[model samples]
Target chain A: MSKQGSASALMAEQSPGPLVAFENVSKIYGKGDAEVRALNGVNLQINAGEFVAVMGPSGSGKSTAMNILGCLDKPTSGRYLFKGVDVGGLASDQLAMLRRHFLGFVFQGFNLLARTTALENLELPLIYQRIEKARRRAMALEALETVGLADRADHTPAELSGGQQQRVAIARAIVTKPSLLLADEPTGNLDSARSHEIMQLLTRLNRERGLTVVLVTHEDDIAAYAGRRLDFRDGRIVRETRNTGKPSHAQ
Target chain B: MLSNTLLMALREIQRNVLRSGLTVLGIIIGVAAVIVIVTLGAGTTRQVGSEISKMGSNMITLVPGGDMRMGGASGAAPPFLAADVEALRRELVGVSAIAPYAQRMDQVIVGNENRRVNIVGTVAEISVVRNWKVTDGRLFTLSEERSGKAVCIIGATIRKEMMAGMEPLGATVRVGKLSCEVIGVLEPKGQAMFGGDQDATVVLPIRTYQRRIVGNDRIAQILISGADSADLSDLKLQITQVMRERRNIAAGERSNFSVIDMTEVAGVMQTTIGVMTTFLSAIAGVSLLVGGIGIMNIMLVSVTERTREIGIRLAIGATEREVMLQFLVEAAMLSAGGGLLGITLGLIGAASIAPAINVPFVFQTSTVVQAFLFSAAVGVIFGFMPARRAARLNPIEALRHE
Candidate 1:
C-alpha cells in the first residue's frame, strides 16, 4: 500500500529482537490451472545474533522463506522488512546493493568460479564492492583464515575436496563482512563428519561475531546446531522451537 | 568497476582460447579483404591517373571513327586527311597547335643491328603540343617540316639499343627502304600505365612520311592542343561540330570522325575505377558482416556456457549492467583484436604485391581507421544480443541451472 510501516510494526518486530521480519508474506508460482502457492501469509521474526535454522521437507516453503530473507526473491504480497526498512519495494539494483553492503550467501553446492583459485573466489564479492585490490586480498585471506582454509587459498575448487571447497565458498560469502549470512542447505552435499565441521564453523561465526545466521536445512541434526528453529509445512510455519538440544558447544 | 569487468572479459576469452580464435577469424578475413582490395584499387587508380597525364593533357586527338576509345579504325571509316586537319585549325575556336599524324611499324638497320620500331609521322607542332623534349639535338624546324627532309627523332629505347656506344645524333639509321638521319634523341619515358614501353618509338615529319613511307596524303590521326585558357571538353565538342560541318554530314546524322579529349577520358576512367573499387570493397564488406555474425554466435555460446558463473556474479552483488558490460567488452576485444590483425595482414599483402606489379603501395590511413571502427561496431552490434541474454537472466533460475 506504500504506507510507512507503522511504529507498532517496529515494536512488534523488536519484541523478538528482530533483525529480519516477514509479515503475512506470500509467494505464488505458475498461473491459472497450474498455479501453486509456495508460501502463504507467513509471519516470522528473527532477532539480532540469532542463528535460526529453517527446517522443512521439499515444497514446504522453507526455501522460499529463506529466499525472501536473503532478498533474493520478492513476496507476492505483504511487507518484509530488514532492520525495520521495507525491502519489498526496493528495485533489483537496490536489492543488489543491499546484498553488497549487508548480506552474504552460502549455497548447497560450492559455487566458487571453476577456473579461479580459492583466494580469487573469495575475492569475487569484494570486486563487486569495488574495494581496492590490496585490501581485498587482505580481507579475503582473513576470511580464509576464519574458515581455517588459509593454506588452501591457491587451490581451485576442482583441486580441493568437497569439504575444503565448501569452506572456500563460506570464505567467499563472509569476505565482505556482511551482517546477515544466508546459508541455503550449506551442509546438504557433505558427509556427516564434514557436515558437523561446517556446522561448527557456522556456530563459531554466529557466536563470536554476533553475525545473524539464517540457515535452511532438512536435517534435524543440522537444525539442532541453531539456537532457534522454525519448521515449515505446506507453505506455512507449523511450529517454532527454542532449541533444548546440545548447546552448539555454547560458544 | 570497469577494469574489473575488462579483466573478467579477458579471462573468459583466455579460458576458451580455441573458440575465441575461431570467432575472431571471420573479422580478420573480412577486414583484411576490405583493406587489401581498397588499398590496391586506390594504387591502381593513382597509377591510371599518372599514366593518362603522362600521355598528355589539354590535348585532343581526332580519330577517323565514331568511337574514340577504340585504338584501331572502325571498319575503314575514311582516315583523316590533311585538308580536314587544316579545316580543324581554321574553324575550331580554341585551337592553339595542331599536328597531322600517321604511324607504322618499320624495320630499322644500323651497323648490322636490326630492330623493329614504331615510327610516328607528325609536324613540328608535336614538339610544342606533346611536350617532346629533345635531349641530344634540336627538333626539326617548320622549314625542315615543309622541305620533306628525311630527318627523324629517336626515343631512348632505340638510342640505347641500336646505337649503343656511338653518338645517336647525326647518325643515319635505315628505315624500311630509305635512309634517314637521327636529328634528335628524345628524353627517356618509362613504361605506360596499361603496360607498354613508351620510349621505344620514333617521330618524323608528316610530309616526309606521306611522300616516302606510306606513299599517300591520308592522315590516320590529328592531334590538337587547346589554348592555355581553353576548356578542353568545350573545345572537343566545338571540334566535333566543325568537323561534322566540314565533312558535310547532315544534321542528326552521326559524324564519321571522333574527337577524343584526353582530360575527359581521364575523368571517365577515374570515375569508372572509383566505382569498381567501391563495388569490390562492398563485396569484401559482406565477409565483415559474416564475421559479426560469428562474434554473435560465439558470444551466445559463451553466455550459455557461463550461465552458472553469471548467476554467481549476480548473487554476489553484481548489477546486471556490470554483467552485460563484461560480455560486451569481451566481444569488443575479440573484434578489435581481429581488426588489428586484419590491418597488419592487409598492409603486408599490399607491400609485398605492389612492387611485384610495379605500383606504389598506397596505404590510406582513413581506410585503416574506418575498418578498425567497423570491426568494433560489429562487436557492439553482434555482442548486444548475447549480453542482453546474460543480463536479463533471473539470478535464482540461473543459479539453479545445472
Candidate 2:
C-alpha cells in the first residue's frame, strides 16, 4: 500500500497535462429575457510556469473568464479541469479545497484586511490552511521578504502607501506557496511609477519562482509584460499573441 | 479552526468597541434582571420560612370566626369557648400542649413610663406552647393561675421600653384600671415575618383578664403545639372534628373557624414566591431575546459593511462554513460576555439590596451557568440568519459591492 501511494505521489508531482483547461465553457447570468451570456463556449489551456495576460473592454467577459479560471464561479454548461480533475462536479467545499491548495488571488483594490498588520494579513491564508503559528509566522515573513516589504510587516494597511499595500497583498497571495497566482488589475490603483514597480515584481516572481500567473488587465502596456496575451470581445477570445523575444514594454 | 475563528471574532469585536457594547446591552440587562429578581425572590422565601418556623416549631394556630391569613375578621361569627380548647386537649392525640388566648389593646402604666400595648390573657401553658422562657423571675404558680391572680409576664420589648435600667421582675405595673405584679420577663423574640414586633406585648392570667377587661369568658385564639413525632395535619384534622362537634356544625357545611399549620403556611409562601420569581424571570428572559435581536441586527450590518471583505476571504479559499462560523462565534462571544457581566452586576445588586428589603442574598451555581448557556444559545439562534446571509454571498457580486 505504501509503495503504491509513493508511486502515485511521484506521478502526481510530474503529471503530464495542462495545469488548467477550459473546454468549450459557458457562463450565463440570468434566465430568458434578462439572460447575459458572460462566456460563450470558450476553450483555453494554460501549462505550468507560464505568465498569461487577458485583455478586454468592460463588457467583453474577460473578468468572467478569470472568475471561472480562479474557481470562484462554475461554468454553466461546460467543463473546467484543474490538474486533470473535473471541477464542475466538485462540491463547494471541494472547490474551496482546490482554491486553497493551488490558487492565490490579488485584487485591484489590494484587499488586505484593514487595521491589521501586514504580517497578520499575510498569515490569513496560512491560517485557513490550518498551519501552526510558528511556521505560519515564518512563512508570512518569508513571503514579505520576497515582496521586499519585510520591514513593513508590522505596519497596518492604513499606514502604508498604495504601492506598499499592493505589495502586502501580493505577499499574502504567495504566502501559501500556491501553484497559480491569479491577479486582476493588481496595479490599477497605483501611480505610473508604483505600477511599474508592481509589474517588475510580478515579472521577477514569474521568472525566478516559475510561478504560473493568470493576470487580467485592460491596459496595453500592462498586457505587454506577459509572455503570452489573449484578447476577449463579446464573451469570446478573438485573438492570441505570443512574445518569443523580450517583452515589448520591458524596462 | 474554531479557535482561529474565535480569535478573529474577538479582533472584530475589539475593532468596534462601541458597536459591540451597544449590541450586547439587552443581554446584559436581561440576564441581570433575571438574576436579581430570582435571587431576591429566593432570599425573601427563605426569610419568611425561617421567621415562621422561629415562631414555634411544630405549632398550629386555630383562630375563631375566620382564617388567620384572611385578616381573621372575628366580627359576627362566635368566638371559641374554653370548652372547645378543653375538648381539643382531651380528644386530640399527639398534642403536646395547647393555649387559648384573648388579646386587647390597653395602656399599661409603669410610673412615669406608660405605653399602650397589646395585653394577652392566657393560661400558664402559653409559655410552654409558645416556647417562651422566663429570662428573669419566674412563671405564675399553678395556684396563682387557677385563682386568677393579677400577675403579668412582660415581654422583652416591654422590659426594654418600660423598665430600662431597672430590674422588671417583682415590679408592679397598672394594667388599664387594674394593678398587676410583674412575675417574669419573657425572652426576646425579634420581628415577625409579617411585620409585627413579636416581643412588644404583656401576658396575664386569662380568668383575671376575662373578669376585669372584657367581662366575658370568650377565647379568641387557640395555639396548639404537637409532639416532635406527631403528624401535624392529622392532629389538625382531629382538632377540627372535635371543634365541629363542640360547635354542633353539620358535616356538609363549611366550618366558621380555621386551623393553620405553620409549616403549611411556609410551604405556600415559598411556592408563591417561586412562581413569582419564574414569572419575573420570564419577563427578563424576553429582554434577552430582544438583546439577541440586537446582536442579529448588528451582525447583519457588519456583513453588509464587510461585503468586499467577505469576497476577499472567499476568493482566498475560506469555506462557507468557516464564514458562517466566524459570525456565529462573534455573536456568541458578545452574548456570553454580556451574560457574565450581568451575573456579576445582578449578584452585587442582590447583595446590596437584600439587607434593605430584609431578605438574605441567595444564589445558585446552576442558575449562573444556565443563564450563561442560555444567553449563548440566544446568540446562535438569532445569529443564524445573518451568518447564513454572509456565507451565501456571491463572491463576484460581493467583491463589486460598494
Candidate 3:
C-alpha cells in the first residue's frame, strides 16, 4: 500500500477528525499511600500530516503519553482513539494487529537486533508481516536507501556508528510503510551533527510521504523541528505551542 | 513463517557455538549411554539365544537339584542311576535319544601340555541328544561304551592346545590317572551361555568314567532330545511321571530332579535381558532429565539476555507467539542435534565394543527413532517455561533492560 495515497484518501474521507485523539486520559500506578500518578486527565490530538513533539522532564509523563499513543500501553481511564476507533476497547492481539498495520516505533537505543546486519534489521517488521523473502529484501533495501544508508546494509549495528545505527533503526521502522512513526528520543544517543541528521530525515519523511510523526524529546532544538509542541509537567500538559521558527511542510 | 523462525533459531544457536555445545553435553552423554546399553543388551540376548540353540533347541537337561540356576545339583539329592536312564529310554514316547551324563574336573596331559578340562562321561547317544558332531574321527562304539573301554572323544580346545601339530584322532591323553585314547574330536562349540568354554572338554564312556574316576555307578544328570514334532512340555511330563513312579516319589512331594528345556532357558534369558535393558535405560534416562534441566536453565538465561531483543521484536509487530516459537525452536534444535550426535557415538561405540564382549552388533531402528523423538520431546518440555517467560515480557520494561 502507498502510505501517501492512503493518508490522503483517509484525509478526504475523514477530513475533520484527528488521526489520533486522547480524551481525559489518566494513568495511576498504585492504589494507596505509595501511589504514583503518571498522567492526569491528559487530552491531546494530532491531525494527519502533522509533526508533533512531546517535551517534558524526567517525571512529567511524556514517556507514558507516548506509550499510550503507540498502543504499547492502555490508558487507565477515559479513551485513546486512533482513526476514530477506540484502542482501549480492542484486545491485546487486536492492538498488536493495529500496531502492525498502521504504526512504527524508533527507540533511543536504536534497538536494532544485535549481531544482525542492517538490511536484516530493516526487514524485521516485514518479516512479522509474513512478507516473502525477495519482496521483503527489496523493501528493506529501498527503506535503507531512503535513509541514505544503502551501502551499509551488510554491516551489523556493532560495525556501524551511532548515526548509521540510528539510520538503520529508522529504515527498519519505515520498511513496512506505516502511516504513524512514533519515535521516542530517536537522537538521544547521537552527537549534535548526527542528531540533526536524524531529525532532518524524520522531517523529510513527514513532508514527502505525509507520514505523521510523534517525537518525544526534552531538547529545545529537537522540539523545534516539530510544527507543534506539548510540554508536560506534574502529570499534566502544562503548555502547548505552535512553532513559527521552523517552516514545516506538514504544517 | 515457521521455516523463517527455524532459520532464525539456527542462527541464534550458531552465534554461540561453544555455549550451545556445552549446554547439550549432558544430553549427548545421556542419549549415547542409552543407545550403547540397549544395543549391547540386545546383542547379548541374541548371543545367548544362539548359544542355547547350538546346544540343541529340543534338548532337555535333567539335573538332580535344589535350584538349578543358583548352582548345580545339591549333594543332598540322590543321584540318578543307570536304571533311571534305561527307564526313561524305554517308557518315554516322542523321545529321539537319551544319555546318562556325569562330569568331573580333572587335568589332562598330552606330551608336555597339562590343562584342566571337564571330564564328561556319557553314552554314545549324547552326540545325538546334545547335537554334537565329530569333526575328526568316530564316536566310541556301543561295545566300547558297554565293555568299559579306555577310549575318549577330545574336544576342539584339547585338540588345538594338546595336539596342535599332531594327529588328534589317535592321541592318548591322561585323564587324571587313566591314559585314555582319543577316538574322535568334537566340533568347536565356542563358549557356554553362563561362563566357561564348551570346547575345552574330554568325553568318555560312562562305565569307564564310573570305574576309573569315581568308583561308582551314580549318574549326575541326564540329557534327552525330544523329536522335532513333539511338544517338549508333554514329553517332559511323561519323563517326569516315569521318573517319579520309578523313584517311588509321593504324589504331592517335590521331585528330586528338575527337567529344564533348553528353549525355555533361552526364553527366560531373553526376558531377563529385556528387563535389564529397560532398567539400565531408565537409569540412563535420569541423565536425560538432568540434561533437560540444563536446557531449561540455559533457556532461562537466554531469555534474560535477549529481553531487549524480544522487546524490539514485539514493538515491531511480532506477536508473543512468534517470540515463544523462536526460542522453542532453538531449544529443540539444540537437544535434537545432541540426540543425533549421541546416536552416532553410541553406534560407533557399540560396533567397536560388541565384538570385544563376544556379542553381535544389533542395530535397532525403533530404538534409534525413539531416542530421537524422546530427545526432541525433552527439549520442548524443558524449553516451555523459558519461552513463556520471554513471550510474557513487558516490551516497555524489557527495552529498558541493560
Q: Candidates' DockQ values?
A: 0.65, 0.73, 0.64
Among all windows of 10 consecutive residues in model 3 chain B, the one with the lowest summed lDDT is B65-74
Each model's backbone clash number: 1, 0, 0
lDDT per residue (tens digit) for residues A80-172 in model 1: 988877899888877777777678889998788997999999888999887899999999999999999899989989999999999899888
TM-score of chain B of each: 0.92, 0.90, 0.94
* Candidate 1 local lDDT, residue A62: 93
Clashing pairs in 3: none
Show the colliding residue pairs in model 1.
A17-A47
Better of 2 and 3 by DockQ: 2
**Clash tally for model 3:** 0
Q: Say which docking band candidate 2 falls in.
A: medium
Per-residue alpha-carbon lDDT of candidate 1 for residues B69-176, written as tens digits (9 for 90 to 100): 634455668887778877877888876789887888888888888988888889878866777788998888888788889999999999898889999988998888
TM-score of candidate 2 on Cα atoms, chains taken together? 0.92
Q: lDDT of candidate 2?
A: 0.87
lDDT for position A10 in model 1: 35
Model 2 per-residue lDDT tens digits across residues A165-251: 999999898888788899999989999889888988999989999989999997888888899999999999999999788876677
Give the Å error, residue B154, model 1.
3.4
